[model samples]
Target: MSENDIERLQEVLRDFAKERDWEQFHSPKNLIMALMGEVGELSEIFQWLTDSEASHLEGKVKNRAREEIADVLLYLLRLSDVLDIDLIEAAHDKLEVNRQKYPVAVFKGSSAKYNEIKD
Candidate 1:
């Protein structure tokens, strides 16, 4: 997604919380906890499923997963807004860091941690 999408989401979330006077409870810590709960709910959707099953979720299961994922993202965006973080810039910076840590030649086809990968 583009930066505009993130900005729009942030604006929507900000207005949503403000509309209900829920901004008082949307502190960074509270938002983080809520985000974690949504992530757990998302994980529950895939629990006990095989890799293929997880990848090929159907019907109600997929719908539930989608809702849970959206919850996670909404909370994350709200938290970022509260903390004045630019999520897009942060993601780009993190990707650059990961690229340096996980060079293609050394990390290709491997799932090991960067430090564990030998040159």
Candidate 2:
């Protein structure tokens, strides 16, 4: 919800890794690979769903989706911690760049890539 929330989650993840002696294996490359795996698992859940079906997930499907999302976030947070990157600030910075690249007046309701948006 806030930067403090991200920090708290990062602390919990740090302790979790330390307790398990997993810090040795938590390199950026390994964490990014694990994060990608979790993302693939999450993608699999939606692979067969129609647009409408995907929008309204529920029951076991939703539970599994949540678990996969948690896995992805944990790995991502762990990776960011190891790299000393502020994930929230990085996200905010990226969003600002995107806003400039895709100004609403020219991009609203359009899904074109920034470079492809014509005058």
Candidate 3:
């Protein structure tokens, strides 16, 4: 998604919370907790599914997954806004760090952690 999309969503979430008088409850810690809850809900959709089934969700299950994912995104965006973090930039920076930690030459086709990858 574009930065504009993220900014727009942030504005929408800000207005939503303000309109509901929920700013006080939107602290970073609370938002993170809510995010984790959403994540759990999302995970539940695939809890007993085979890998193929989880990858190819359909009908009601897919719709539920969509809603749960939206919840996760909303809570994450709210938390980032509360903490004054630019999520896009932070993600880019983290990706760069990960690239350095797990170089293509050493990490290709490997599922090992960075520390476990042989030189």
Candidate 4:
């Protein structure tokens, strides 16, 4: 999604919390804990799937996976909001760092960590 989309979602979440008087409960720590919980739930959906099964979810499984993904994203966006983080920019910055660390010339098709790759 674009930065504008993220900003819009953040505004919506902020308003939702305000309407429910939930801002008091949306501290960074609380949001992070909730985010982790959602991630675990999402992971559970694929825990038993083989590689092919995991890659190609069907019908109800796909729907359930989508819901879990949405939950994870909501909590993540909320956490970013609480932390005053611009996730889009942060992601771009991290991607640049990753490109430097995993240069394609040396790391293409390789699963090794940066430190494990020899010159």
- State each candidate's clash count: 0, 0, 0, 0
- lDDT (tens digit, per residue) of candidate 3 on 1-119: 89899999999999999999999898778888899999999999999999999999999999999999999999998899889899999999999999899889888998999988655
* Tens digits of per-residue lDDT for model 2, 6-100: 99999999999999999999999999999999999999999999999999999999999999999998898899999999998999999999999
Q: What is the lDDT of residue 77 in candidate 3?
A: 88
At residue 95, candidate 4 shows an lDDT of: 100
TM-score of each: 0.97, 0.97, 0.97, 0.97
Tens-place lDDT per residue, model 1, 7-97, is 9999999999999999999988999999999999999999999999999999999999999998999999899999999999999999999
Give the total clashing residue pairs for model 2. 0
lDDT of 2: 0.95
Candidate 2 lDDT score at position 99: 96
10 residues in a row with least lDDT, candidate 2: 110-119
Model 3 per-residue lDDT at 105: 88
- The runs of at least 3 residues in candidate 1 whose Cα sits more than 4 Å from the true structure, single-residue gaps closed, are none
Report lDDT (CA) for all predictions: 0.93, 0.95, 0.92, 0.93
What does candidate 2 score on TM? 0.97
